[model samples]
Target: MMGGARVRQEEPSVQKEANSWVFARSFRSEEEAVRLANDTPYGLANAVYSVDAARLARVASQLKSGIVWENCSQVLFPSTPFGGKKGKASGFGFEQGLAGLKEFLAEKTVVGTSRPSYNWQIYKKA
Candidate 1:
């Protein structure tokens, strides 16, 4: 609705895939905004702008995306885990999290009973 009355709209600055950004007017309510944002196939990232921190946090949690930025553009850090939800856009695994660290380590499970019991098969009557 922001870009005239056309149903489909894209940012005027966008000229190619490298410059992709969909700019649309806000819906009636926050729920509608979340619904429209999550309807996409790719849950790569999403940005929410709001003056109220609580409301911004609430909306961010409802989004289907793995990465959510509030009142700011996308910024990456070495410590923060980077990845998306289930979809083609989502990578194999997180880049900086416990899960990501696990990807580089070997997994092993140790099993044992608190009390040891001998097998009766050795003295079983045949």
Candidate 2:
């Protein structure tokens, strides 16, 4: 409910346990919604619900969280890559998918010449 530049302010809050809910004042615009959501120190995950697909996509893109759910929450899939920020201090990198596999893998490069007589000295001029 927006009228002119008036902004309704409510108490900020957080819940420690599961299934607990905290309520805050409704946002007047999309920019306000993104700002309020990102005001928190934590940005692990977030979710948005809307009948408009384009609006949902636009909002989801601007959210600060690493993972975002559209019209759904916490629907984890094995094939989907999951991880927090690069320096999240979460004790792990991505957990699933090809990107996750690369975290624990060590890659090495190898080279060889197949010529019968090969002169490997490049600095010596003939």
Candidate 3:
């Protein structure tokens, strides 16, 4: 763990309310930070600060967490899928745009019928 104080500083207010949880602080470099983030047994969300877009992309790819916030904290949109890696159980499918809407619905496919029916399946199941 980076440090209790550091995690507290980087985490959001809601996250702070979870007494059972521990937050890790921001890393100096994307590499160092990602290393620490990935090292943890639980792969959750990771926040990165990078003024450079290229650097952010590089770091985002390396992070073990499912969600990576560049120069920001937390996932903001419902359409944006949020989940965790490693042992942390968050989610398993995308949650944004049409893809996200699909997650909440079921699709049925009818074949060889008088009228053609579209397939409605959950995003993850599909």
Highest lDDT against the true fold, candidate: 1
TM-score of candidate 2 to 2 decimals: 0.63
Per-residue alpha-carbon lDDT of candidate 1 for residues 13-64, written as tens digits (9 for 90 to 100): 3222222555565577889788866765567677889999999999999998
Candidates 1 and 3 compared by lDDT, better number: 1
In the order shown, the candidates' Cα RMSDs to the true structure are 5.2, 5.9, 10.2
Ranking by lDDT: 1, 2, 3
Task: List lDDT for all candidates, in order.
Answer: 0.67, 0.66, 0.62
Model 3, 13-118: lDDT tens per residue?
3233343554556556657666656654455577777688998899889987767888887657865656556455455655666666877899998665454344
Clashing pairs in 3: 7-23, 7-24, 79-95, 79-96, 107-120, 107-121, 108-120
Residue 57 lDDT (model 3): 93
**Runs off by more than 4 Å, candidate 1:** 1-19, 87-89, 105-108, 113-126
For all candidates, the clash counts are 0, 0, 7
List the candidates' TM-scores in order. Answer: 0.68, 0.63, 0.51
* lDDT tens per residue, model 2, 54-74: 999999999876678999878
**Model 1 TM-score (2 dp):** 0.68
Q: Lowest lDDT 10-mer window, candidate 1?
A: 9-18
